[model samples]
Every structure is written in structure tokens, then in C-alpha cells.
Target: MTAHLPVLQVVIPLMAAAVCAALRPARVAWAFAVLVSWTVFVIAVLLLREVLAGGTISYEIGGWAAPWGIEYRIDVVNAFVLLIVSTVGAVVLPYAGDSVEREIRRDQIPLFYTAFLLCLTGLLGITITGDVFNVFVFLEISSLSTYTLVAMGRERGALTAAFRYLVMGSVGATFIVIGIGLLYSVTGTLNMVDLGLRLSELTATRTVPVAFAFLTVGISLKLALFPLHLWLPNAYAYAPSAATAFIAATATKVAVYMLLRFFFTVFGATFSFDTMQLGFVLLPLALVAIFSMSLVAIFQVNVKRMLAYSSLAQIGYITLGISIGTVTGLTAGILHLFNHAMMKAALFMALGCVIYRVGSIRIEAFHGLGKRMPLTMAAFVVAGLSLVGVPLTVGFISKWYLILAVLEQGWWPVAALVLFTSLMALVYIWRVVEAAYFHPSPTDEVAAAVREAPLSLLIPTWILVVVNVYFGVDATLTVEVAGRAAEALLGVPR
Candidate 1:
């Protein structure tokens, strides 16, 4: 059982998703999904413990050996990613019952849960698989489910958002497949570890560099990097609240994980860093994304759309950390990977509460949120502070490390930009706070109609908010694990 933990971790949710699809009762399906999500979280925790205790664990699918057969490899880096993804999935599912019921048509509710579980299964599979082809297969599985989930939005425009995301996601997947084909043509293998080994032996090849370029661009689109991120705001803003909370918190983060796996694990440090100097490219784009997206967010009238743009800017921070390309830098990148997920999930879930009572997520609806829905808006404040990178929040820890990472490289200008953009974050976050706390509530039926969101939504929202603060004050766990993951990927024991 212990030996099969790697495959079991993914297979459980995947198989359960099928069962969920088979059952038609939305409530039953939701219950099953909640159980499966928590179970997956436990399995992920167990797998992480085993990996940390025993180093990397390799599980060959169906007892077939690697290089010839499919493999599921577990290491410090991926194990940590698995934990982050699973943690978000588990937290989001319990909150889904209320959010999904409110946003989705009754008949489609069961399918929503089914799609959600399948998406979860796909993300976990992508994180755990050691084969490059397997990554693409799972990417599509997650993506198709994502399209369905987004289309479940109550808004009529949700179909457009879903279609747009489908188009962009398809293009990204196609590029990734083309890249994999090039690598296979050069190395005659599809397994990532084997491909890495073969490439190390081969000198510079036209195909290899082209493959590298292809993978980078494709992953950039998937991770919603900068200009490629146009599809994300719509995908998230128009999705069902539950879907938005889950996807915003997990999907792009997993894509970032895929990028890290390819750059650090598949390409190796010399090729990705020294020869190609990917950081030089990522640095400028990351800076632009940080500032440009932050400015765009400040102007948005819709609160959900505002945070959607903010998520893109946060991704910029993650990429900035990666662009620094040092042990400290990678650690910051990975730490923010988890930190951003926590804070954003909390924020979106808080929005989920507002959308519950009132259908609109516009700024005007929140004019008196602090007074009416005190608990939910308070949760939003804590999470918003975290988003602003305020001290005593998870966002602050991530930025603290990013600053150290930039300063370590003597890039004072970039460091200054980071601090400046963070202040921009405060500006956008404050916009909501002002509307919610300072402005007067509408004096008509609108204010009379809106009430406090149910505990079902508020509890999950606060859980993440509390964790955001708790983890900020005690960075021992997240920092230590992220440091080890970074050290493993960089091959430098720090």
C-alpha cells in the first residue's frame, strides 16, 4: 500500500470522479466529492511525509520499469506542489455546496461536481507524472473539465469566457505537444528523466533549442504569463463562484509547477539558466506584468474582475522570483506559489459569499459589506492584507523572500520595483476596503435585501484567511519545505 501511494494518490480521485458522474443526485455527488477531496489531501500529506523521510520515491505504472514504461516520480519539489494543489482542492470542495447551488442550475449541479473532481484528478496527475506525454494527457483532462466548469456560470457571458479559454488552452496544449514531439524525435524517448539524461549527452542541437522554445511559450500561455494572460481574467471572472475559487487558486499554480519541472528537471540548470538565460527574458515580462496588471486592476469596476487582474499580477511576482534564478529566488517562487493560492482562495471564497446574497460582484454592491456581512468582509480584509503583502500575512513572507532573493543578486532596481508594485497592490486592495467599509449602503431594497452570507461559505473563507495569517507568523513549515524543494531542483544544498 505504501509502495503504491504515488499512483493511488491520483487514481482515487480519478476513479471517484467517474462514480460521481454516474450518480445523478447533486447533493450525493457533492458529498462524494467532499469525501474524495479530503481523502486526496490526506493521501498527499502521507506521500509528502514518505518523500521527506525517504527521499525520492519512484512508482512505475503497472510494474513497468522507467525509460520504457510510464513512471510516477515523487521528489521534494513535486511532493510540495502536490500538497499545495491538494490542500486547495480540499478546502474549496466543502465550500462548493453552497456556491455551486447558488450559481449552477439544479440539473447541472451534479455534473459540476463531477467535472470539478475530474479537474482535480487531472491536476494531481500532471503534478505526479514523470512522463512528458502523461503531462499533456492530464493537462487536457483538466482543461476540458475546466471549460465545462467555467461555462457553468450563471452569467450568459460565461459561454464566451469558456470558449475563449478553450481556444487559448488548446493552442497552448498544441504547442506543448509539438515540443514533446521534437524532444522525442531528438532523444527517441518520452520520459522526462530519460530525456534529460539523453540531452545532457548530446551537444547543442537545433531541435533541442526549438523544443525548449516551444515548451517555454506553451507553458507561459498555460501559466497565464503576462500578455498570454488575457484569457484568465474572463475565465475566472465569469466562472461559477466555486469554479472560480478552485481554478484561480490551483490551475495557474499547477502550470507554474509544470514550468519549473521542465526548466529545472527536464532541461537541467546549465541549459535553462547558463546557455539560454531564460531569466533575462522572464525578468522584463514579469516586471511589465506586475506593474501593468496592477494598474489595470485598480481601474476595474467589478470586484471579481479586479481580483482576476490582481491574480495575473501575483503571477508576475511568482515569475519574478523565478527569473532571479537562485536558490533563494526559487524558494521565494515556490513559497509564493503556496502563499498566493491560500490568499487568493480566501479572497475568492469571500467574494463567493457576496455573490451568494447578491448576484452582482460589482464594487457598488459592497458599499456597506462591512456593516451587513461583517464576518465575510472581515475575512476579505485579512486576505486582502495578505494580497497587499502586509506584514503578519502570507503575502509578506513571500515578498520578504523575493526581496532577499533580488538583493542577493544585487538587482536593487528590481527590488525597488517589487516594493513599488506591492504598494500598487495596496492601492487596489484599498479600493475595495474603502467601498466596503467607508461608503454608505444603498438606501433601497438593495441594502434591505442583502444579508450576512451563510456559515457554509463564511467558514471555509475564514479557514483560509486564518491559515494565511498563521503561516505568515510561523514560516517554518512552508519556508523549510520550499527551501528543500528549491535545493532539490537547483542541485544546491542551501
Candidate 2:
């Protein structure tokens, strides 16, 4: 049963999605979706525990041996990602019921849940699968469902955003597939571990670099990294609040994991760094993303769009850690991957609650929110502080390590730049805080009617808020696990 955890995590959601589409009643479909999401979350937790306790678990599909049969490989890196993706699904699905009902038509709710389940399954499958081709299949599964989910938004521009994302996402997927084909042509194996072993032998070949270029560009686009992030703000802004929260938290994080896996595990560190010099190329881009996006975030009139830009800046910090390419740096990068997920999810969910009651996420709409919806506004404040890297918050832990990583390289200027970006984060966050607490309500009627969001939304949002602080205060679990995961990727002996 334990050995089958990987398959169950993905299969449960995939099967539930099909069943959801067939189910007539929206309530029944939602219940089934919730059950499947929770099941996957449990499986992910179990998988993580097993990996931490006993190291990697490689399960061959259909009981066939690897190098021929497909593999579901579980290690610290992907197990952690599995936990992140599934946990987001588990938390968001419950809140989604209320939020989606308000935003999407009654008749569309069932289909919305179906697409949500399929997207969840795809993300989990992408993290768990060790077969290269399986990643592309799952990627498409998630992308298609995401398009449908985004298109279901009540806003008129949602269809346009969804269509634009569909076009960009499809092109990115094609690049990834072509890269995989190039790799397979040279190595003749689709299993990640096997490819890792064979890729080093062909490092001098021109095809290796070509494949790497394709993969880097493709994954960067998917992850919404800096210059390639044009599609993200519109996507997050126009989508339904629930869809925005879910995708903001999970989708790009999974793509980052895939990028880390391919660069560190499949390509191997020596080929990626020493021979190809990927670190030099990525480092500058990450820095530019950190500063430029934060500036853009400060100017956005819509709160959701502001957070979307902030999300891109946060991705920069994660990428910066990866570009450092050392054990400490990689640990920082991986830990940020988890921390950012929690913080962003909490922040977006808080905005979702605001949108639920106020029917808008504009910055001005937040005026006097503290007096009207104190609890919901308080949740937003806490998450905002976390985003600013306040002490005893998960965001601070990530930034601390990122700075330490730069210092380790004796790059004082780079370290200072990181601090500068944090100050920019502080400025934008303060803008929202001032609007929520200090400014008077635009209209007294809105102030009179506003109350805390329903418990359904508040609970999940606060759970993530509490986690942001809890993990910050006690960094042992994240630090240790990420350290081990980093060491493994760096080829250090256990």
C-alpha cells in the first residue's frame, strides 16, 4: 500500500474528475472533488514522511523494471512539491465551493469542479512521474483544464485572458516536447534517472546545449519568470478569485520544481554549471526580475494585479537561489518554493474573500476595510507583512537564506540589491495596508454592510497565515528537508 502511494495520489484525482463530469448534481460533484483532493493530500504527506524516513522510492508502473517501463519516483525534492500542490488543492477546494457559486453560473459549477480536479491531478502527476514523456502529458492535462477554469470567470475579459494564456501555454508546451525529443534522440531513454546517467556522456555534443536552451526558455515561460511573464498578470487578474488563488499558489511552483529537477537531476550539476554556464545566464535575469517586477507591483491599481506582480518578484528570489547552485543556495531556493506557496495562497485567498463581499479587488475598494471587515483585513495584513519579509514570517526566512547565499559568494553588491528589493516590497505592501486601515470608507453604506467573510473562506486563509508564522519561527523541518534535498542534487554522499 505504501509503495502504491505515488499512483494513488494522481489516480484518485484523475478518476474523481471523470466521475465529477458524469455526476448531475453540483453538490455531489463538489463533495467528490473535495474527497479526492483530501485523499491526494494525505497520500502526499505519507509519501513525504516515507521519503524523509527511508530516502527515495522508485515504483515501476505495471511491475516492469525501469529503463523500459515508466517510473513513479519519489524523492525529497518532488515529495515536497507533491505536498505543496496537493495541500493547495485540499484547502482551496472547500473555499472554492462558495466562491465559485458566487462567480460562475449554477449550471457551470459542476463542470468547473471537474476541470479543477483534472488540473489538480495534472500538477500532482507532473511532480510524481519519473518518465520524461509523462511530464508533457500531465503538463497538457493541467494546461487544458486551467484554460477552461479561467474561461469560466464571470468577468467579460476572462475569455480573452484564457485565450491568450492558451496560445502562450501551448507554444511553451511545444518547446518542451521538442526539447524532450532532442534529449531522447541523443540518450534514447525517457526515464529521468536513466537520462541523467547517459546525458553526461554526450555533454560535448551540440544537441545537449540546444535541448537545454529549449528547456530553459520553455519552463521559464510556464513559471512566469521575469521577461517571459507577460501572460501571468492578465491571467490572474481576469480569472475568478478562486481560480486565481489556486493557480497562483500551485502552477508556477510546480514548473519551478520541474526546472530544478531537469537541471540538477537529469542534466547533472557539472554539465549545467561548469560546462554550460547556466548560472551566469540565469543570475542576471533573476536579479532584473526581482527589482523590475517589484517596481511594477507598486504601480498597479488593482490589488490582485499588484499581488500578481509581487508574485513574479518572489519567483525572482527563488530563481536567484537556484542560480547560485550551491548546497545552501539550493536549500534556500527549495525552501522558498514552499514558503512562497503558503504566503501567496494566503494572500490571494484573502483577496478572494474581499472580492466575494465587495465584488471588486481594486485598491481603492479596500479603503476602511479594517473597520468594516476587520478579521478578513487582518488576515490580509498578516500575509502582507509576510510578503515584506517581516521577522517571524516564512517570507523572512526565505529572504534571509537568499541573502546568506549571496554573501557566501562574496557578492556584497548582490546582497545589497536583494535588500533593496525587499524595501520595494515593503513599500508596495504598505500601500495596501494604508488603504485598508488608514483611509476612510469611500461610502458609508458599504462600510455599514461589510462584515467578515464567511467562515469557509476565513478558515483556509488563516490556516495558511498561521503556517507562514509557524514555519518562520521553527525552521527545522523546512531547513533540514531542503538541506538534504539540496545535498542530494549536489551529489553529496548521504
List candidate 2 segments past 4 Å from native. 444-447
Q: lDDT of all the models against the reference?
A: 0.93, 0.91
lDDT tens readout by residue for model 1, 46-97: 9999988889989999988998999999998899989988999999999999
lDDT of 2 at 488: 86
What are the C-alpha RMSDs, in order, of all predicted structures?
0.9, 1.0
All candidates' TM-scores? 0.99, 0.98
CA error at residue 302 for candidate 2, angstroms: 0.5
- Which parts of model 1 are misplaced by more than 4 Å? none
Name the weakest run of 10 consecutive residues (lDDT summed) in model 2: 442-451
> Model 2 Cα displacement at 279 (Å)?
0.8
